[model samples]
Target chain A: MLALAFQLARRDLRSRYLGSFSGGAWALLQPLVQLAVYAFVFGYIFRQRLPGADAPGYVPFLVVVMWPWTAFAEAVSRGTTAIQDNASLIGKVALPRAALVLAPVMASFAIHGIGFLGLLLVMLLAGAGLAPAGLALMLPALALLFLFALGLALLLSALQVFVRDIAPALPQILMLWMFLSPVFYGRYVMPEWVRPWFDLNPMTGFAEYLRYALLNMPAPGLRAMACSVGAVVLVLALGLFAFRRLQRHFEDFL
Target chain B: MSVLVEAHGLGKSYPRVFRRSDRFRSLCSLLAGRASGEVTPVLQGIDLCVPRGQSLGLIGDNGAGKSTLLKLLTGVLTPTHGSVRVNGRVGALLELGAGFHPEYTGRDNIAMAATLQGFSADDLAARLADIVAFADIGRYIDEPVKHYSSGMVVRLGFAIVAATRPDLLITDEVLAVGDESFQKKCIRWMEDYLEQGGTLILVSHSMYHIQKLCRQALWLREGRMQASGDVFEVTQAYLAHHERKSAADEARARDLDAVRGLEFHVRAMRVNGEEAETLPAVEQGAALTVEATIASRDGRVPVVNVGFARADGTPVYGVSSDMDGVQPAPLPDGDFRIVLHIAELPLLPASYTIRVHPLDSEGLRLFDTVERTLTVKGRSSESGLVRLAHVWEHAAPLSRSRGE
Candidate 1:
């Protein structure tokens, strides 16, 4: 599965480059620029104080959260349409359909990793140097992030086969998710009572964990972690079932 | 003997249309707990087996389910009702440049395209040089493919595909991918593939290609296999049906002319000849012999002209007696079947129509007219609208025996 995922990732990146002049450098640059903008706005312009944040500045905090959010957002946005975009491939080849969802996940992961490294630098500049303890959580954090994106990608990609609107609607929804998840504001900033309502977001948990683990603060609430894992499994199981149901019908539609 | 692909009772279907925006509908339905609608059948009960080394031709009209069948047999689509079990590796070119990216360089695209076809980086590493050399667009192999000309794009595509050499190669009409030379190269490559015992199934429109390459042909009509057997047998059926349809159209034109009103006092019309006129047989590519006449209503003019037409009411060509650079002298009264003469008639006959119109003095219409047909029948080298004199040669002669 990983081998296939890598092949599809290579194809996915190549197509992004092929279809546009900027190539994949543009993809890497877009998020980098987004980070810079947020840094300018929050770290310099606003210079808002972090209450318990030995975390240095807010944008680096925002960067860590936004990077993963972008991955999840871009994965579902592009991944749902992956099968639709490669209708020629879907129409002609007998491929393991999971590759469609996995391809975008890998591509998003590659770009997001660059943002992660950039976040590391910004945090260091903002007076928060990495601790060995903070570094240890990276893999688990990435895995949880990966699982969350993969599950949603699979579900939306399958639904896209039957209903194409998922491909376009995802980005708008992702933007909505960004504001809701604490990319610009922490979930803790919400009231104690409404915080539970915000915890319904699997991503709210993942982003809070990035803030906590990377900044020497507390991780996302335990309930959010539990719910996020459940959401991944649920999305994956239901996505596969929908994919299996729609798999036989795709050629005719193409 | 190698058996590369087998499909038994394979089928697939799709709903005629879900609204293009059905994603929103599906989301709405999902949130509301409703199931999606049922599917409509597209392919029903198809059984086909392609042995190694044989090229199978699939010919059908649009919507005959040819593309759908190719998808099912190649495993791009699973059968809704049955099974498809393929042996060894399979390559399907259901569409050319299936996963190509416009922004990527040719080399990068090739690497990515091969990987999508289940190739590993190592596999591509081994074949990369050969694929590049085969594509033959120097220097531009590293440039983005969007800059490549259409012809160049096809070269890159065919290069990657030809390098694969799978156990089974299933291709749609996408082989019409390049120029004539490339098309010929593709066919030659397929012939060589067959020579080496690779199995190939091709869906094509060219009867010439089907006859030359396929030992057997499957004819599909409206999504069901109409006939499957020797290539010659099935092609003959397709051609015969086409001829019958055109003939019925010719018969309808003849009946319409019987009721046309012309200013001339009386008579009938037709092109070259059908029910009313016949000419002496001439060599192929000779001018047509013509015949049509009009009786005088009041001796206004002796102007007569005949038009040659195809079965569908289209004129083949026309000429008139009035063009001596001036109208023919006015006619005196006499009932006449005008025998307009030509030295040669250049037509390959299935059926032809001649519309005979009568003009009065000053080239004005005042009375009656007619449209008719000319049916030419005989075994001739010429089969379409035009006839040609051609050469025939035989390499060997065989003796015939009375007893089997």
Candidate 2:
């Protein structure tokens, strides 16, 4: 099953940029362009910065959170439509159906993860105040974030097979989710009453932890960390349960 | 022999999703672990057991669920009712270019298909040259599958399946698209595969192919098993049903009341003592008695003619009383009765129609006709309408070749 998932992920990645001139380089380049646009809008125009005077630059602060968020958002949006997109394959071939959902998630993470690593290396050399040791320390957090995205992906992809509105509405929902999370700004920028409520949003733990690891910023509270971990475990279990229950009926509806 | 495939009360039904709301409702119910309501059943209650080395043909009309059964057996589609257990690796070529991604090159699709069949990368690499060679599509192997002709698609599809050499092969009418040469190559490969103890399940509209390849056959009609057994019997029965359906359509166009007004018309026609539109099936070489009662509007002698034809309207033989230098015997009620009996009917096993016509005394100017369907039942695989009487000369006995 793992081998099949890898084969499908490779196929998915190759087919995405098959006819393009830049080919796979576009996977990394697209996110770089998005980062440039965000840097211009927030760093230059809005003059967004971290709270403390000793904080790292605005671009690195945004880069750490934005890259992982892009991976999560792309993974969820692409994975949601995986089953519906492969309706012809599911009806004709007998294979592990979950692999279809897993492929897109794996592809998203692989492309964005490589881009994130390369950008961090470049920042470290540019004297952006990023801790070299924190890069090693952040591996566990990155792995956890992958599981969180995968859990949501499995859940949404299964629902998308039956309710097609999920795929079309996913982009708007992810945009709202990103704005609500601490992607563009820190939770400290929000009003005092809402600061504590940020713990409920799983992305809060992720965004704060990435900054804390790489930018030497304040870490997320223990309650927020526990809440995010609990959410991942609960969502993963629900996703697996829903997927296993609904996978067999996919062909009938498709 | 160990069974390679076993299915019991297998069935499938699609949930009715005419409205958008139904899909949502079905999702909710399915998630709640309840059966979705309002389903249209496409197949039901199919029981099959195919032993290793056995070749089975699936014969059915369009929409008869032959493809559905094949999908269930191959584990492509989940059965809604019962279970199917397949104990070996199965290779299936369902419909045209099944499991092929249109945007991918044929070579790429082969790798994907090989992976789906549980072949490791090394296994596919070893057989890659053989697959490309067997397909024989030349440079089209590197072209996108959507750009290839339908015949080329089947060639590539069949070549991959042939290379897999699965323990059980299930194909669904895909061979019909291939050119004759490619088709012959596939059949030759399948024959060799079968000889090596591979099991097969085949679906084809052409009974000739079924009879040539399969030893056992199953007939499905309206999602139900009509008949299953020896290939000859099931295929013959399926063909006969089709023949009767077409004959019935033709029979509806000719009204009996309109024919009664003719100068001389056939009043009744019977085959083998039974007077019905369709008679019971008769064994091959069995005696057949065709009796016809002709009514003459005027008190004049009428000549009777008996003709045998395949149900598709291919005439086999025709004979008239006048040709035999005889006349129909007149009855007291002013009707003429003629009986034509063949000591041994030489017709092969298939559906045939017997036509009785009343003509004037001169054996010309046929007035009216009545037809009855006769089915010949046997295990003979001989081709053509009738069996010819002949002898093989200077032929050695089979035991002599084996030195028994």
Candidate 3:
């Protein structure tokens, strides 16, 4: 099953890279354009800056947060229809069901790799000092973010099969989710009272941790990071549970 | 032979949701562990078994649940009731190019499909050349499957299934497509597969192919078992039933056509002086008699025509009273009765239809027809509609000569 999953994932990644008009260059270009837009709107127009310290310009700052955020959003949206879109496979083939859900998630992760490269380049051009030790921290933060995204993907993909409205409603919801996570601004921008509410969003700790990993910025404290990791584990369990429960009826409905 | 696959009272039912809102509601209700909507049964109480090394054909009309049964056996759909136990690995071609990623190359799709079928990466590598050779798609194997034609897709699909070489091979109408030569190749492969003690469960609408391939057969009608037995017996029975049904339908349609005309009408028909009713069974060399009564408008004798045809609508022979220089005998009520007789029927062993037609006295045009189907019951090695009365005599062989 694992072999098949990797095989399917590799094919999916290569095909998506080749299926579009721009091929793999589109994967690099999309995040680059999005980061530039965020930088212009927030850094130049709104003049937002990191609180009480040296700021690594908004483009590099936004790139750090957007890298993981984009992956999570893409995974969730793509995963929503992973099983439904493969209705032919489900109807005609007997395969490990979880592989369908994982394929899209892993594909999203692969694209994220290209986006991270763009982030690294933007940081280098912005003259952010290279801190190898601090850079190592990105691994744990990125791993946690990947797990959280996969969990959401598993849950949402199963739910979308039963309730089709999830597919159409996902983009707007992700837009709202991006605003709620501090993709454009720092956590300090939120007033103390609203700061508690900000921490309630699991992605806040994630974005803050990723920024800290790359930019030598302030972290979300130990409690927020622990809570985020705990939430990741909890969502992973619930996602798998719901996915296993829903998949048995997938053939009948799909 | 050990049992390869067994299904005891297997069934499946799908909930019918009439409206989009109702579909959402039913889905929610189902997820909530509550009864959803009105259940429509697709298949029910289907009990069957395929022994190892046996070839079983699943024959059915459209909507008779043959596809559903194959799906159940292959574990694509869970049975609603009872259970199915399969003893060995199963490779199926349930649909052409199913599970193929359109954007992936044919070779890539083959690797994925083979791996999903439980072949190791190394196993796929070893068999890659053989699979590519069998598919015979040539350079198209390197192109994405989306660019492949339907036949090409089936070629790649069947090639992969062949490479998997599972213990039990299940296919649903896989032989229906592709060109004649490819279909012949698949049939040849299937023959070899069966010969090597491989179990097969084939589903097809073509009785000829099924009879040629399968040793045992199961016929399904409206999701119920209609017949299950030897291949020849079940296919023959099913075909005979189909022939009678279609003939009746055609007769009804022709009856409407016969009502519109007033000049000539056929009233009754008899075979061998007995009223031609349901299909009557006869043997070779039997004296065949056909009598038909016709009514005319003006007390003039109308030409009567009798014809014979195979049940599949192939014309065998036709003769008219006018052509034979025989006049119809006048009846009491401006009606006429025509009697046609054959001293010895030369038809081979198969179902046949005798058609009676009324025409003008000159036999220049045809008016109406009434048909009766007869089954020639005796068996012979000869084929086709007629049994030619001829003999072969022994001859001595001559020695070969030098270059002419």
Q: Which parts of model 2 are misplaced by more than 4 Å?
A: A48-56, B252-277, B291-302, B327-339, B358-360, B365-371, B390-404
Per candidate, native contacts kept equal 0.57, 0.78, 0.63
Per-residue alpha-carbon lDDT of model 1 for A1-254, expressed as tens digits?
Answer: 57777877866666666568887677768887987787766666554553423335555566667777777777777778877877866765677878877888889887777667766766666565554466567668778778777777777776677665667777788888777776777666667898887768877777777777776657777888887777877887777766666655555555
Residue B78's lDDT within candidate 1 is 71
lDDT of 3 by residue, B1-404 (tens): 79999999998888776677876776677667665677788888999889889999999899999999999999988787779999999989888778788878888888888888888888999999989999999999999999999899989988888888889999999667788989999988988888888889999988778877788899998988999988866776676677667665555546645444667778888998677455567878888889899977666788888899877777899887877678889887768997888899998766778988888776776777777878876534355679888866796655632111
Model 1, retained fraction of real contacts? 0.57
The alpha-carbon deviation from the true structure for residue B168 of candidate 1, after best TM-score superposition, in angstroms, is 1.7
Q: Candidate 1 at residue B161, lDDT?
A: 76
Give candidate 2's iRMS in Å, 1 decimal.
Answer: 0.8
What is the DockQ score, from 0 to 1, of model 3?
0.44
Worst 10 residues of 1 chain B by lDDT: B252-261
In model 3, the clashing pairs are none
Tens-digit lDDT track for model 2 on A71-179? 9899888888989999989888889998898888899999899999999999999999999998888888888888888888899999988898988888999999998
Winner by TM-score: 2
lDDT of model 1 at position B201: 81
Candidate with more favorable, higher DockQ: 1 or 2: 2
Arrange candidates by DockQ, descending. Answer: 2, 3, 1
Could you give the CAPRI-style class of model 3? acceptable
**Candidate with best DockQ:** 2
Q: Give the C-alpha miss distance for residue B90 in model 1, angstroms.
A: 2.2
